[model samples]
Target: MFVHFGLYAVAARHEWVMNREEIEAERYARYADVFDPDLFDAAALARTAKQAGARYVVLTAKHHEGFCLWDTATTDFSAAEALMAMCRELQPHMIVNDRLGIPGDLVTPEQYQPSRPLERDGVPVLWEACQTAPRDAALFAAIGEWMHRHRRAVHGAGPSAFTAPSGVTYTQRGDRLYACLFDWPFGLLHLPDLAGRVRFARLLHDGSELRMREIPQAQQAFNMNPAAPPPGTLTLTLPTRKPEVALPVIELLLWDSP
Candidate 1:
């Protein structure tokens, strides 16, 4: 279970309310004055997670908005020490997403960590927050489901050289390659990198096999120059109807791991 609670809760708006609305820092700091989390019971939260069969809970101690949920000597703009102690007691693995002028156990990609070390007790676990509107349950569910389905690729995969149209990103994990398509193409998706490397292709969503073929690059008028490299255009036939998900992923099994 993951929980996000801070001064932003006082505004009853999204987490990035300060930045998205372009409010001044001093003006936005006033939210901390009225921030009263009287109903925030860390023990009750832990009990609820246990009832729901959750293994662990991750609480956002400080978000990108730079509002600290715990009291610190560096800033008076804090929720105070009592809440932080309770949270630490209930949830030891707290996530401090912003630089609060204090040392933290973990650091996110967006944070600047020049003075602090990346790892201390163990390998630092990187946390990536998915920014989404409140109550957008479908999108959240889709993202969580996608991550769960491709847990191996999510952890072990790295950026791939494989090329695709706009809104598409590629990642490869050993013999398997993944293409995350954010925008649905018309009817055909072209991949220029995996010309002869792809052994199989399928949609990850429903395990639907897709038809694919390679076209010689020389066949195109753009490659009229004899010095031009040999053309190997790999195109996958996509379904006319797009899948019902936040993002669609196409899995490619390569003949050789690159």
Candidate 2:
């Protein structure tokens, strides 16, 4: 399945953008925290999209610069290594908890207390593994053998021996609670690293009806509204097909206001 999600509005909510590229690029896919899970993880957001009936999640991992989604050692401006994000200390986990009301097993202060960083063959934390395996995450796993080495060591080591902070709240909205539809604008999206066809539907009457269709674009995802009006949602999933999926417009013409 494909989806047309809104990002500029979300960036606006975060006070991160004033225009098209500025909002979509710096605040999402290309943003430093876009995939931190603890900070900008897409799983929960994507899950919310999926619960709304999406099957593919096309995002702008990189903007016009040919940058990247995760930490790119190639340049210091990458979303993973952008010192600005770390300086801001944005709490993605907390945001997830707040927006989704995850009821996340209630982590105690002791759990949140800063712990010493771990090392791999004397190397510091690598943002590539993404708290999971890489082969499945080619986007984040672009760090080469060095990343693989550390990850192999960690995966082989198993869960943290130290008492870690509490995590995961099943009561999240992204799962299946309030499946609100998100409608993004074409001007608010861009992914230089993606390409393919998109399959999605138009939401109507409070999402009671879903009409399916296919859209072919070089990009990953897009919005239903070409310009602007009532906001809606475009549900989606991650890449698994041989090629990256495209962003097809999934327009909705209704609003919740009177």
Task: Pick the lDDT winner.
Answer: 1
lDDT of 2: 0.30
Task: For residues 43-81, write the lDDT of model 1, one tens digit per residue.
Answer: 977765555444467787877787777887655435545
lDDT of 1 at 178: 88
Q: What digit string (tens of lDDT, one per residue) describes model 2 on residues 100-200?
A: 12222122222142244434468544221112222233333233232232222223222222221122111111111111122232222221111122232
Question: Candidate 1 at 162: error in angstroms?
Answer: 2.9
TM-score of 2: 0.19
Give residue 128's error in model 2 in angstroms: 32
Which is the leading candidate under TM-score? 1
- Worst 10-residue lDDT window, candidate 2: 168-177
Q: Give the clashing residue pairs of candidate 1, or none.
A: 217-231
As a whole number from 0 to 100, the lDDT of residue 136 in candidate 1 is 51
When summed lDDT is taken over every stretch of 10 residues in candidate 1, the lowest stretch is 221-230
Cα error, candidate 2, residue 10 (Å): 10
